[model samples]
Target chain A: MKKVLFAMALALAQTAWADGGMDILKSQCSSCHNLTGPAPQTLKELWARKGPDLFYAGNKYRKEWLVQWLQNPTRIRPAGEFYEDHIKPGEKHDEIDPATLKPHVSLSKDDAQAVADALMTLKPKSDLIAKEKIEEGTISKSMGEMVFDKFLGCMACHRIEPDYGGLSGPELYTAGDRLQPEYIASYIRSPQAWDPKIWMPNKHVSDMNIQKLVHYLEALSQENKNGK
Target chain B: MGNKLIFLTLLALSLPALAKEAARDNYRTYCVQCHGMAGNGKGVNIRDMSVQPRDHTDAKAMSARSDDTLFKVIKEGGLSIDKSVLMPPWGDTLSDDEIRDMAQYLRTLCKCKFGGN
Candidate 1:
């Protein structure tokens, strides 16, 4: 049985090596991404999600950003994929592996677009997206930054820019362009609902605050002077 | 804090040889980065940190805060209690009971308890 499994794995790797895009998703991305259907129903199930669920990538990611990111991927989550994957003894403050994480596989432009196209078809939560509206101008830069950094304490876990915040959560500098507004609001409303036991706290964020945070992220994405 | 059973439990390694080990291991794993091996808050990360990590060895300081307060800071991060955001939450990492153990172990470090002042 082990021999058979090894053979199957070898075949899959060869197939992905020979092609890109959808083939890559099946053979490579499938190892981590849940590409099939319904999201994790429980905490145990959530743990199996080694990478962010691409099953609903269509609903979560912006297609243009996905295309660009696939061509030249960067680290989003400061700690590798999971929160406690590389936590070890005799280290400093929840260290994750080392200086930085290993780079993701880069693809050609055409391949990137192809993968993006394929991923965009996996939209499961259109209802959630339909209710989202980008109500801009409500949160000013200073006010938004104040709430994001202090009031709500998102900056502790999430980074608004490079090397600015705690290194436990995903970076949010490109969240405006990378993620859907509705997704952001929904996630902050309750991170555990999406990925139970995820490091991000619910914070019991108010409805107004959620909108403000989303607004902040959107504005931050727009105000890019440097760094990826 | 409780009846005789609880008192005996408390007498058992001051309640947490197991819990103490857990708290020590957790401190080593998480807090020692900034709190240091001796609970002196002179952790290796201090050089880069803008503010100093709290000195657990400072009996006067640690004693001033209540166990519930310590639990809150550990479980919810420093910002939840209007403290520094630099103190990241361990809610997702450590269990509630574990946090409680950590709070108790902290008492051992300072060798002091809250006087309700």
Candidate 2:
């Protein structure tokens, strides 16, 4: 009878643990993130959003990255996600006090793992990222630089090298180290798909270019690693 | 009458200064990231880019270009001028008046006239 009771208790505990993940998400994350989403369609609606939509978190972020980031949160957007709202009339953005920025809520390792597991299950459009993959060493570093600087004008917003390029967007020099190749391709193809109000405009890049870009990112990351 | 004339002259002088300040503010908002805070072209992105952003403070280089060229580059982008595509077009984002103001501001940065004497 004790053996049977132990087995039953184990099953019950497992079920509760599964539910615990969802419960934690609803209680902690739903306030800022759109856990369920059809990303904001218009700029006005996008600006209204307080945090990045996580409905496609499974497709967008690596599970390991999510777990680590949850435990030790840092600002991803140098300028706030809605930069227009953050820039004061007579001050430089970099001059703004870091203390004034809203801090992201940190989580314990167990909670972060549970929350990441729950978030990974929230993938809605898996098809968008299905075919994207990073192929290593296909494009030379110089060729990738050409595509980034000359062809796409990406240098205007994204930084591929340290201290070079525009600062309006996230630095791309560390992107290969930081992002999934599929996520990079998907975001580049249609930034609005992930966040409608994001300042990045959809450049309608071709599939071939997308491949080249991912390969370039991987190459850049490798270069960064070597340089370091 | 003398006081009124002096007041009018000061106001006239301050108008350009005020406009220049406004232009500087606009530069801070948009160009400072890539162009540096002092228009030295050593922006934060300097390490990432292959081509250097134009240094507005370089009097020799700035004086060589015409105001029309500066206006065109700002409005249409470097691609229009056979320059690097790294400089994105601002025509859709900025008004004609703003571009003109920015060009004037660039002149102040270089401390040189655009047209050759």
Candidate 3:
């Protein structure tokens, strides 16, 4: 009788926390995040989007990173969510008006945990993965930088460090900690496949170099943690 | 009747110029991030960019390319013209008429008409 009761308790436990998590998500997160989505299918939808699509957070993010970020909260996009939104003409060059940007909302620790749990349950694009197993392969520091800057020209937008690269894309120093390796590779391979109208171009990076890029991102993330 | 005719004539003359003026807004919105507020290729984002944004004000250089080439580049992307991918395609964002006006606006910036290569 104890064993049967324990079995029932285990089953209830699996759903108990998730129910709380789902409630928190529906209440707080659904306003900005697309919790249930076929990701913005048109340019109009893309422009109308308020926050990053969380429908695939399970496939995209690391849970620990998500929880920590939700509690602390930071601006990921240097030029705001849509680069065109807050831009104004300055005397020298066009500037992103700091006054116009509203930072991501921070949640309390308990709320963050529930939100992260709910987010991790969303994996809409599981099929978008490496055809073969991909690992974080090695890349020489110079060669990796060359591939990022010269060969591929990712420095035109993405930044490896703070205040370093172009402002249009998200900072990449914490990419490894923030994103899963498979997610990174899959994204670089075909950004359009995931966010069809997203400005990130399909570079057609070779498989070997894709692994190298993943390794580079992981190393950069480590360097950030080490205070470099 | 004379005043009305004059007003219509002036409006007709200014229509193309008005279109170019309108395209300047698009330029300010999209291109100015990398192409500079003055189209001098000294955009704020150029500080870390390995490749420089093309200076629309470079008359001698701008005259070498035709309007068709310029339109293609703006619509398709720089990669479409064997240029850098840093100049992203605007086909999805800007309409065909807007892009055509952008090409026209670039001509105004250079102050030299492209007769073809």
In DockQ terms, which candidate is top? 3
For model 3, what is the error of residue B39's alpha carbon versus the real structure, in angstroms, after optimal superposition? 5.6
What is model 3's native contact fraction? 0.33
In candidate 3, position B107 carries an lDDT of 88
Candidate 1 at residue A104, lDDT? Answer: 74
lDDT of 2 by residue, A37-118 (tens): 8776544555566677788877877778788878998666554544434433223322223443587899999888878777
What is each candidate's fraction of native interface contacts (fnat)?
Answer: 0.05, 0.25, 0.33
Q: Residue-wise lDDT of candidate 3 within A1-228, one digit each (tens)? A: 999999999868756766788898888878878888877655456667767888899999999998899999887888776676666667756677889788888888877877787788888788886453576367766788787877777887788888788876788889989998999999987786677656565666788878888888888888889996
Error of 2 at A113 (Å): 0.9
* TM-score of every model versus the real structure: 0.66, 0.61, 0.78
**Per-residue lDDT of candidate 1, residues A1-228 (tens digit):** 999999999878645643456786897788777888566544445445667878888888999999899988988876665444533334444345654355678888877877887787777777776666757656788999888876766664567777676555678988999998888987887675555445465576788888899988988888863433
TM-score of chain A of 2: 0.78
Tell me the lDDT of model 2 at B7.
100
Candidate 3 or 1, higher TM-score: 3
User: Chain A alone, TM-score for each of the models?
Assistant: 0.81, 0.78, 0.91
- Could you tell me the TM-score of chain B in model 1? 0.79
lDDT of 3 by residue, B1-117 (tens): 999999999988974232222587677656766887678886657777757899999998898889899999888878889999778777654667888999999988889888632
lDDT of 2 by residue, B14-114 (tens): 74221222566567655765676668776554555667789889999889889999999888877789987667666544557878999999998999987
What tens digits encode model 1's per-residue C-alpha lDDT throughout B1-117? Answer: 469887787687562122223676666556754576578776544534556779887888988899999999999888778887667777755678879999999998888898632
